[model samples]
Target: MIDEQTARERVVSAADRLFYARGVQAVGMDAVRSESGVSLKRIYALFPSKEDLIVAVLRHRTDRWNAGVTDAVDGAGTPRERLLAVFDFLAGWFREDDFRGCAFINVFGELGGGSDRIAEAVREQKESFRRQVADLVRAAGGPGHLAPQLVLLAEGAQTAAAISRDPDMAGHARAAADTLIRCALDDAGEPAAAA
Candidate 1:
Protein backbone atom coordinates (compact mmCIF):
# COMPACT_ATOMS: atom_id res chain seq x y z
CA MET A 1 0.00 0.00 0.00
CA ILE A 2 2.75 2.44 -0.87
CA ASP A 3 1.55 5.94 -1.66
CA GLU A 4 2.20 7.41 -5.09
CA GLN A 5 4.98 9.68 -3.83
CA THR A 6 6.68 6.81 -2.03
CA ALA A 7 6.45 4.55 -5.05
CA ARG A 8 7.85 7.30 -7.22
CA GLU A 9 10.79 7.82 -4.89
CA ARG A 10 11.49 4.09 -4.76
CA VAL A 11 11.46 3.84 -8.53
CA VAL A 12 13.77 6.82 -8.94
CA SER A 13 16.19 5.58 -6.29
CA ALA A 14 16.41 2.15 -7.90
CA ALA A 15 16.79 3.67 -11.35
CA ASP A 16 19.58 5.97 -10.18
CA ARG A 17 21.70 3.10 -8.84
CA LEU A 18 21.07 0.86 -11.82
CA PHE A 19 21.52 3.57 -14.42
CA TYR A 20 24.65 4.94 -12.79
CA ALA A 21 26.23 1.52 -12.34
CA ARG A 22 25.36 0.44 -15.87
CA GLY A 23 24.51 3.04 -18.45
CA VAL A 24 20.86 3.91 -18.93
CA GLN A 25 20.62 1.87 -22.09
CA ALA A 26 21.85 -1.27 -20.41
CA VAL A 27 19.37 -1.33 -17.52
CA GLY A 28 15.91 -2.54 -18.34
CA MET A 29 12.58 -1.64 -16.78
CA ASP A 30 12.23 -5.08 -15.27
CA ALA A 31 15.47 -4.59 -13.40
CA VAL A 32 14.05 -1.41 -11.95
CA ARG A 33 10.91 -3.29 -10.98
CA SER A 34 12.96 -5.99 -9.26
CA GLU A 35 15.21 -3.50 -7.52
CA SER A 36 12.45 -1.18 -6.36
CA GLY A 37 10.06 -4.05 -5.61
CA VAL A 38 7.37 -1.99 -7.25
CA SER A 39 5.28 -4.30 -9.37
CA LEU A 40 5.67 -3.87 -13.12
CA LYS A 41 2.16 -2.61 -13.42
CA ARG A 42 2.69 -0.06 -10.69
CA ILE A 43 6.02 0.99 -12.16
CA TYR A 44 4.47 1.64 -15.52
CA ALA A 45 1.57 3.36 -13.89
CA LEU A 46 4.05 5.64 -12.15
CA PHE A 47 6.24 6.06 -15.22
CA PRO A 48 4.61 5.23 -18.50
CA SER A 49 7.80 4.18 -20.27
CA LYS A 50 11.52 3.60 -19.79
CA GLU A 51 12.31 7.01 -21.24
CA ASP A 52 9.85 8.57 -18.87
CA LEU A 53 11.57 6.85 -16.00
CA ILE A 54 14.96 7.98 -17.23
CA VAL A 55 13.75 11.56 -17.42
CA ALA A 56 12.24 11.26 -13.99
CA VAL A 57 15.49 9.89 -12.57
CA LEU A 58 17.48 12.74 -14.08
CA ARG A 59 15.05 15.29 -12.68
CA HIS A 60 15.16 13.67 -9.27
CA ARG A 61 18.95 13.70 -9.23
CA THR A 62 19.08 17.30 -10.37
CA ASP A 63 16.75 18.45 -7.62
CA ARG A 64 18.44 16.62 -4.76
CA TRP A 65 21.96 17.15 -6.03
CA ASN A 66 21.45 20.84 -6.71
CA ALA A 67 19.93 21.46 -3.30
CA GLY A 68 22.88 19.96 -1.46
CA VAL A 69 25.70 21.51 -3.50
CA THR A 70 24.01 24.87 -3.92
CA ASP A 71 23.60 25.07 -0.17
CA ALA A 72 27.34 24.56 0.24
CA VAL A 73 28.05 27.24 -2.33
CA ASP A 74 25.50 29.65 -0.93
CA GLY A 75 26.55 29.29 2.67
CA ALA A 76 30.03 30.71 2.04
CA GLY A 77 31.06 33.85 3.91
CA THR A 78 32.01 35.77 0.77
CA PRO A 79 31.41 35.78 -2.95
CA ARG A 80 34.92 34.51 -3.71
CA GLU A 81 34.46 31.86 -1.08
CA ARG A 82 31.19 30.93 -2.71
CA LEU A 83 32.97 30.44 -6.02
CA LEU A 84 35.62 28.26 -4.41
CA ALA A 85 33.00 26.41 -2.44
CA VAL A 86 31.76 24.90 -5.70
CA PHE A 87 35.00 22.96 -5.99
CA ASP A 88 34.74 22.07 -2.34
CA PHE A 89 31.31 20.63 -2.99
CA LEU A 90 32.67 18.67 -5.91
CA ALA A 91 35.48 17.37 -3.74
CA GLY A 92 33.02 16.06 -1.21
CA TRP A 93 30.96 14.42 -3.94
CA PHE A 94 34.01 12.76 -5.45
CA ARG A 95 34.85 11.15 -2.11
CA GLU A 96 31.72 9.03 -2.06
CA ASP A 97 32.38 5.31 -2.63
CA ASP A 98 29.68 5.29 -5.28
CA PHE A 99 31.02 8.36 -7.06
CA ARG A 100 31.20 7.90 -10.81
CA GLY A 101 31.52 11.46 -12.07
CA CYS A 102 28.45 13.63 -12.58
CA ALA A 103 25.21 11.91 -13.40
CA PHE A 104 24.40 14.46 -16.10
CA ILE A 105 27.78 14.02 -17.76
CA ASN A 106 27.57 10.23 -17.56
CA VAL A 107 24.05 9.94 -18.89
CA PHE A 108 24.65 12.52 -21.58
CA GLY A 109 27.64 10.63 -22.86
CA GLU A 110 25.64 7.43 -22.99
CA LEU A 111 22.42 8.72 -24.53
CA GLY A 112 22.61 12.41 -25.34
CA GLY A 113 22.86 12.59 -29.12
CA GLY A 114 19.91 10.32 -29.80
CA SER A 115 17.74 11.43 -26.93
CA ASP A 116 16.44 14.94 -27.09
CA ARG A 117 14.96 14.75 -23.63
CA ILE A 118 18.20 13.55 -22.09
CA ALA A 119 20.22 16.25 -23.81
CA GLU A 120 17.77 18.88 -22.69
CA ALA A 121 17.98 17.71 -19.11
CA VAL A 122 21.78 17.68 -19.14
CA ARG A 123 21.86 21.10 -20.76
CA GLU A 124 19.51 22.47 -18.16
CA GLN A 125 21.68 21.21 -15.34
CA LYS A 126 24.84 22.56 -16.94
CA GLU A 127 23.24 25.94 -17.51
CA SER A 128 21.96 26.04 -13.99
CA PHE A 129 25.45 25.32 -12.70
CA ARG A 130 26.95 27.99 -14.90
CA ARG A 131 24.39 30.52 -13.75
CA GLN A 132 25.22 29.84 -10.14
CA VAL A 133 28.90 30.42 -10.83
CA ALA A 134 28.07 33.47 -12.87
CA ASP A 135 26.21 34.95 -9.95
CA LEU A 136 29.16 34.25 -7.71
CA VAL A 137 31.57 35.70 -10.21
CA ARG A 138 29.60 38.94 -10.46
CA ALA A 139 29.29 39.15 -6.73
CA ALA A 140 33.04 38.53 -6.33
CA GLY A 141 33.88 41.57 -8.49
CA GLY A 142 35.43 39.45 -11.26
CA PRO A 143 35.02 40.55 -14.85
CA GLY A 144 31.77 39.42 -16.48
CA HIS A 145 33.74 37.35 -18.95
CA LEU A 146 35.15 35.19 -16.17
CA ALA A 147 31.92 33.33 -15.49
CA PRO A 148 32.17 30.96 -18.46
CA GLN A 149 35.87 30.44 -17.90
CA LEU A 150 35.20 29.54 -14.29
CA VAL A 151 32.62 27.02 -15.44
CA LEU A 152 35.21 25.41 -17.71
CA LEU A 153 37.54 25.10 -14.74
CA ALA A 154 34.82 23.58 -12.62
CA GLU A 155 33.87 21.01 -15.26
CA GLY A 156 37.49 20.25 -16.06
CA ALA A 157 38.07 19.65 -12.38
CA GLN A 158 35.25 17.13 -12.35
CA THR A 159 36.66 15.22 -15.33
CA ALA A 160 40.18 15.31 -13.97
CA ALA A 161 39.07 14.28 -10.51
CA ALA A 162 37.12 11.38 -11.91
CA ILE A 163 39.94 10.24 -14.21
CA SER A 164 42.68 10.60 -11.64
CA ARG A 165 40.40 9.32 -8.88
CA ASP A 166 41.95 12.09 -6.84
CA PRO A 167 39.77 14.56 -5.06
CA ASP A 168 42.75 16.91 -4.83
CA MET A 169 41.95 18.22 -8.27
CA ALA A 170 39.41 20.31 -6.42
CA GLY A 171 42.31 22.00 -4.69
CA HIS A 172 44.06 22.62 -7.98
CA ALA A 173 40.92 24.13 -9.44
CA ARG A 174 40.39 26.22 -6.34
CA ALA A 175 43.93 27.55 -6.56
CA ALA A 176 43.39 28.52 -10.15
CA ALA A 177 40.17 30.22 -9.15
CA ASP A 178 42.00 32.10 -6.42
CA THR A 179 44.63 33.23 -8.87
CA LEU A 180 42.00 34.43 -11.29
CA ILE A 181 40.24 36.38 -8.60
CA ARG A 182 43.49 37.95 -7.43
CA CYS A 183 44.48 38.97 -10.90
CA ALA A 184 41.08 40.44 -11.54
CA LEU A 185 41.24 42.51 -8.40
CA ASP A 186 44.83 43.61 -8.94
CA ASP A 187 44.46 44.68 -12.54
CA ALA A 188 45.65 48.30 -12.49
CA GLY A 189 45.15 49.37 -16.07
CA GLU A 190 44.99 52.81 -17.65
CA PRO A 191 41.28 53.03 -17.02
CA ALA A 192 42.05 55.37 -14.11
CA ALA A 193 39.33 57.99 -14.03
CA ALA A 194 41.60 60.54 -12.29
CA ALA A 195 44.86 60.67 -14.25
Candidate 2:
Protein backbone atom coordinates (compact mmCIF):
# COMPACT_ATOMS: atom_id res chain seq x y z
CA MET A 1 0.00 0.00 0.00
CA ILE A 2 1.16 3.51 -0.77
CA ASP A 3 2.20 5.74 2.10
CA GLU A 4 -0.07 8.50 3.30
CA GLN A 5 2.04 11.23 1.67
CA THR A 6 2.09 9.46 -1.68
CA ALA A 7 -1.62 8.86 -1.52
CA ARG A 8 -2.26 12.45 -0.56
CA GLU A 9 -0.13 13.66 -3.45
CA ARG A 10 -2.01 11.49 -5.90
CA VAL A 11 -5.34 12.71 -4.64
CA VAL A 12 -4.29 16.34 -4.81
CA SER A 13 -2.84 15.92 -8.28
CA ALA A 14 -5.98 14.27 -9.55
CA ALA A 15 -8.20 16.83 -7.95
CA ASP A 16 -6.14 19.69 -9.35
CA ARG A 17 -6.41 18.33 -12.87
CA LEU A 18 -10.16 17.88 -12.58
CA PHE A 19 -10.73 21.16 -10.82
CA TYR A 20 -8.69 23.09 -13.37
CA ALA A 21 -10.29 21.50 -16.42
CA ARG A 22 -13.77 21.63 -14.96
CA GLY A 23 -15.04 24.01 -12.34
CA VAL A 24 -14.32 22.97 -8.74
CA GLN A 25 -17.99 22.64 -7.87
CA ALA A 26 -18.55 20.45 -10.91
CA VAL A 27 -16.00 17.87 -9.77
CA GLY A 28 -16.94 15.58 -6.90
CA MET A 29 -15.18 13.14 -4.61
CA ASP A 30 -16.08 10.19 -6.82
CA ALA A 31 -14.36 11.80 -9.76
CA VAL A 32 -11.32 12.46 -7.61
CA ARG A 33 -11.28 8.85 -6.48
CA SER A 34 -11.58 7.65 -10.06
CA GLU A 35 -8.94 10.05 -11.33
CA SER A 36 -6.60 9.34 -8.42
CA GLY A 37 -7.26 5.61 -8.28
CA VAL A 38 -7.42 5.99 -4.52
CA SER A 39 -10.35 4.59 -2.59
CA LEU A 40 -13.05 7.03 -1.55
CA LYS A 41 -12.48 6.20 2.09
CA ARG A 42 -8.76 6.85 1.75
CA ILE A 43 -9.39 10.11 -0.05
CA TYR A 44 -11.66 11.29 2.71
CA ALA A 45 -9.12 10.23 5.31
CA LEU A 46 -6.54 12.37 3.55
CA PHE A 47 -8.91 15.28 2.88
CA PRO A 48 -11.85 15.48 5.25
CA SER A 49 -13.82 17.65 2.84
CA LYS A 50 -13.75 18.87 -0.73
CA GLU A 51 -12.72 22.24 0.60
CA ASP A 52 -9.70 20.68 2.24
CA LEU A 53 -8.79 19.02 -1.05
CA ILE A 54 -9.24 22.29 -2.86
CA VAL A 55 -6.87 24.08 -0.49
CA ALA A 56 -4.25 21.37 -0.95
CA VAL A 57 -4.60 21.63 -4.71
CA LEU A 58 -4.23 25.40 -4.56
CA ARG A 59 -1.09 25.02 -2.47
CA HIS A 60 0.31 22.56 -4.99
CA ARG A 61 -0.45 24.87 -7.90
CA THR A 62 1.06 27.84 -6.06
CA ASP A 63 4.28 25.92 -5.56
CA ARG A 64 4.45 25.16 -9.28
CA TRP A 65 3.67 28.74 -10.27
CA ASN A 66 6.31 30.07 -7.91
CA ALA A 67 8.89 27.61 -9.20
CA GLY A 68 8.22 28.47 -12.84
CA VAL A 69 8.59 32.18 -12.23
CA THR A 70 11.72 31.68 -10.14
CA ASP A 71 13.25 29.48 -12.83
CA ALA A 72 12.50 31.97 -15.57
CA VAL A 73 13.98 34.82 -13.60
CA ASP A 74 17.05 32.81 -12.63
CA GLY A 75 17.70 31.87 -16.25
CA ALA A 76 17.95 35.45 -17.39
CA GLY A 77 21.31 37.23 -17.57
CA THR A 78 20.27 40.66 -16.37
CA PRO A 79 17.75 42.24 -14.07
CA ARG A 80 15.82 43.77 -16.96
CA GLU A 81 15.74 40.47 -18.80
CA ARG A 82 14.71 38.81 -15.57
CA LEU A 83 11.74 41.12 -15.29
CA LEU A 84 10.70 40.34 -18.86
CA ALA A 85 11.33 36.64 -18.37
CA VAL A 86 8.05 36.54 -16.46
CA PHE A 87 6.19 37.25 -19.68
CA ASP A 88 8.33 34.72 -21.51
CA PHE A 89 7.25 32.15 -18.94
CA LEU A 90 3.63 33.09 -19.46
CA ALA A 91 3.98 32.78 -23.24
CA GLY A 92 5.19 29.20 -22.96
CA TRP A 93 2.53 28.36 -20.40
CA PHE A 94 -0.17 29.79 -22.68
CA ARG A 95 0.93 27.47 -25.47
CA GLU A 96 0.36 24.39 -23.34
CA ASP A 97 -2.64 22.32 -24.47
CA ASP A 98 -4.14 22.34 -21.00
CA PHE A 99 -3.58 25.99 -20.24
CA ARG A 100 -6.61 27.41 -18.43
CA GLY A 101 -5.15 30.69 -17.25
CA CYS A 102 -4.11 31.24 -13.62
CA ALA A 103 -5.49 28.59 -11.29
CA PHE A 104 -5.52 31.03 -8.37
CA ILE A 105 -7.56 33.50 -10.36
CA ASN A 106 -9.92 30.81 -11.58
CA VAL A 107 -10.52 29.42 -8.11
CA PHE A 108 -10.92 32.85 -6.58
CA GLY A 109 -13.56 33.80 -9.11
CA GLU A 110 -15.37 30.52 -8.57
CA LEU A 111 -15.57 30.47 -4.75
CA GLY A 112 -14.07 33.65 -3.36
CA GLY A 113 -17.24 34.91 -1.73
CA GLY A 114 -18.28 31.88 0.27
CA SER A 115 -14.94 30.34 1.18
CA ASP A 116 -12.69 32.21 3.54
CA ARG A 117 -9.84 29.72 3.41
CA ILE A 118 -9.79 29.58 -0.35
CA ALA A 119 -10.05 33.35 -0.60
CA GLU A 120 -7.14 33.79 1.78
CA ALA A 121 -5.05 31.34 -0.20
CA VAL A 122 -5.75 33.22 -3.39
CA ARG A 123 -4.98 36.55 -1.77
CA GLU A 124 -1.68 35.25 -0.46
CA GLN A 125 -0.63 34.04 -3.90
CA LYS A 126 -1.52 37.38 -5.46
CA GLU A 127 0.31 39.34 -2.80
CA SER A 128 3.31 37.08 -3.26
CA PHE A 129 3.26 37.79 -6.98
CA ARG A 130 3.14 41.54 -6.38
CA ARG A 131 6.07 41.28 -4.02
CA GLN A 132 8.07 39.30 -6.57
CA VAL A 133 7.41 41.91 -9.24
CA ALA A 134 8.41 44.64 -6.89
CA ASP A 135 11.71 42.93 -6.17
CA LEU A 136 12.40 42.50 -9.89
CA VAL A 137 11.61 46.16 -10.49
CA ARG A 138 14.03 47.27 -7.80
CA ALA A 139 16.74 45.08 -9.25
CA ALA A 140 16.13 46.53 -12.67
CA GLY A 141 16.52 50.05 -11.26
CA GLY A 142 12.93 50.96 -12.01
CA PRO A 143 11.02 53.51 -9.99
CA GLY A 144 8.55 52.34 -7.34
CA HIS A 145 5.54 53.15 -9.47
CA LEU A 146 6.60 50.81 -12.29
CA ALA A 147 5.95 47.59 -10.40
CA PRO A 148 2.17 47.89 -10.20
CA GLN A 149 1.93 48.84 -13.90
CA LEU A 150 3.99 45.81 -14.84
CA VAL A 151 1.90 43.59 -12.59
CA LEU A 152 -1.26 44.83 -14.25
CA LEU A 153 0.18 44.07 -17.67
CA ALA A 154 1.16 40.53 -16.66
CA GLU A 155 -2.17 39.80 -14.94
CA GLY A 156 -4.20 41.29 -17.77
CA ALA A 157 -2.19 39.31 -20.31
CA GLN A 158 -3.12 36.04 -18.65
CA THR A 159 -6.85 36.86 -18.53
CA ALA A 160 -6.88 38.10 -22.11
CA ALA A 161 -4.89 35.17 -23.47
CA ALA A 162 -7.16 32.69 -21.75
CA ILE A 163 -10.40 34.32 -22.88
CA SER A 164 -9.28 35.38 -26.35
CA ARG A 165 -7.43 32.11 -27.03
CA ASP A 166 -4.40 34.04 -28.19
CA PRO A 167 -0.97 32.99 -27.04
CA ASP A 168 0.39 36.06 -28.76
CA MET A 169 -0.97 38.02 -25.86
CA ALA A 170 2.28 37.27 -24.07
CA GLY A 171 4.28 38.83 -26.87
CA HIS A 172 2.09 41.89 -26.76
CA ALA A 173 2.44 42.16 -23.01
CA ARG A 174 6.17 41.68 -23.29
CA ALA A 175 6.44 44.57 -25.70
CA ALA A 176 4.38 46.75 -23.42
CA ALA A 177 6.57 45.78 -20.48
CA ASP A 178 9.71 46.64 -22.39
CA THR A 179 8.29 50.08 -23.14
CA LEU A 180 7.27 50.57 -19.54
CA ILE A 181 10.65 49.56 -18.21
CA ARG A 182 12.44 51.85 -20.60
CA CYS A 183 10.16 54.75 -19.87
CA ALA A 184 10.37 54.23 -16.17
CA LEU A 185 14.13 54.14 -16.25
CA ASP A 186 14.18 57.25 -18.41
CA ASP A 187 11.88 59.06 -16.05
CA ALA A 188 14.21 58.17 -13.21
CA GLY A 189 17.05 59.70 -15.25
CA GLU A 190 18.75 56.33 -15.57
CA PRO A 191 17.78 55.45 -19.14
CA ALA A 192 20.74 53.13 -19.56
CA ALA A 193 19.66 51.07 -16.59
CA ALA A 194 17.08 49.24 -18.69
CA ALA A 195 19.81 47.92 -20.91
- Top-scoring candidate (lDDT): 2
Q: Write the per-residue lDDT of candidate 1 for residues 92-161, one digit (tens) a residue.
A: 8888888777788989988899899889988988888788878877777678777888788888988888
Give candidate 1 misplaced runs (Cα > 4 Å): 188-195
Candidate 2 ranges with C-alpha deviation above 4 Å: none
TM-score of each predicted structure versus truth: 0.91, 0.96
What are the clashing pairs of model 2?
none
True lDDT of residue 114, candidate 1 = 83
Please give, for residues 89-184, the per-residue lDDT of candidate 2 as tens digits: 999999999998888889999998989999999988888889999999998778999999998999999999999999999999999999998888
For each candidate in the order shown, give its overall lDDT on alpha carbons: 0.83, 0.92
Worst 10 residues of 2 by lDDT: 185-194
- Report RMSD for candidate 2: 1.1
